[model samples]
Target: EPEVTQTPSHQVTQMGQEVILRCVPISNHLYFYWYRQILGQKVEFLVSFYNNEISEKSEIFDDQFSVERPDGSNFTLKIRSTKLEDSAMYFCASSGAGNYGYTFGSGTRLTVV
Candidate 1:
């Protein structure tokens, strides 16, 4: 079965530093998404990309954050300035059309000190 893969499994950075989390979703999937879960908090959606554009985004996806598919197979989330409050597990997911068959990556754990 195909799977979404994330890099660096874990990361630690100083507050205000920039960081980019990477993911490779299932090749055939058409919808891509970014989500995050702060320690002890619920998983929250940040943005969803489809047809090479942002289809939807949550309030959390502020100007400080951005997502890109630099390559057709790779999706990335960049934080311009990491904050202590940004420490969390960032997840990348993809799904087929009609919003079915969604799969989530293992996630990149971001720790801002």
Candidate 2:
């Protein structure tokens, strides 16, 4: 089966540097989303994009964050400036809009120092 794949399963970055977390969603899916889990916290939705524009975004998605489909197969999340609070497991998900559960990437563990 086709699954979402994320790179650099683990990432370590400086507090003020930029980081781009990458993902490749399932081929036939249309809705794309990014969620983050801060250590033991519940998963929080960051943004959802469709039709080449943002459909919905949570407050967590601030000026420092942006997302793009750089190619036919790759979706990327860029953080302009990393903060200590930014350390978390960022998961990429996609769904085909049915009763099926969203498929999540293994997740990229971001650590800011």
Candidate 3:
């Protein structure tokens, strides 16, 4: 089975710093997404991309967050400025056409201090 893969399994950054989380979703998937879990909280959707454009985004994905499909296989999420509250496990996910079930990456643990 194909899977979504994330880099820098863990990251540490200071407040106000910039960080880019990288991911490689399944090649055949038609939809991509980003989600984050703040420690014990439920997973929250940040944004979704389809056909190379942002199809939807949540309020949590404000000006500080950006997503890109810079190449055929890579997806990225950039945080313009890190905040203590932004620390969490960011997950990258992808789903096939007409399918809601997503294959999620293990996640990149962001630690802001």
Candidate 4:
């Protein structure tokens, strides 16, 4: 029953500030992903990391955004400059296999004011 864990469950930052969200997924999982849910919008995939590199990223992942696995167990997403629209609940997820379901972290709610 391994699960993904995220720190700083909540964060508040001023506009134009940089923000980093950290996460540690199930050690045994092979795929790691970052998703965001705007106040009342559907979950959107931001990026996916595999084999220590970005396997895929959505249009939202522009030059302002980046993802990294500094260590084998920790995955992080960094937003170079925050904006009001960037505020959302960010979730980290991991899956052992494509066919298997994902285990998501409780999520880190980012608030930009």
* Highest-lDDT candidate: 3
**What does candidate 3's lDDT look like per residue over 1-113, in tens digits?**
77789998999999999999999999999899999999999999999999999999999999999999999999999999999999999999999988478999999999999
Identify the runs in model 1 with alpha carbons over 4 angstroms from their true place.
Answer: none
lDDT digits (tens) for residues 1-113 of candidate 1: 89999997999999999999999999988999999999899999999999998999999899999989998889999999988989999999999879476799999999999
lDDT of each: 0.93, 0.94, 0.96, 0.94
TM, every model: 0.96, 0.96, 0.98, 0.97
**Model 2 Cα lDDT, one tens digit per residue, 35-110:** 9999989999999988667899999999999999978888999999999999999999998877788999999999
**Model 1 clash number:** 0
How much does candidate 2 score in TM-score? 0.96
Q: Give the range of the ten consecutive residues with the poorest summed lDDT in model 4.
A: 1-10
Candidate 2: deviation at residue 54, Å?
1.2
lDDT of 2 at 103: 93
Candidate 1's displacement at residue 47, Å, is: 0.3
Q: Give the best candidate by TM-score.
A: 3
Candidate 1 to truth, TM: 0.96
TM-score of 3: 0.98
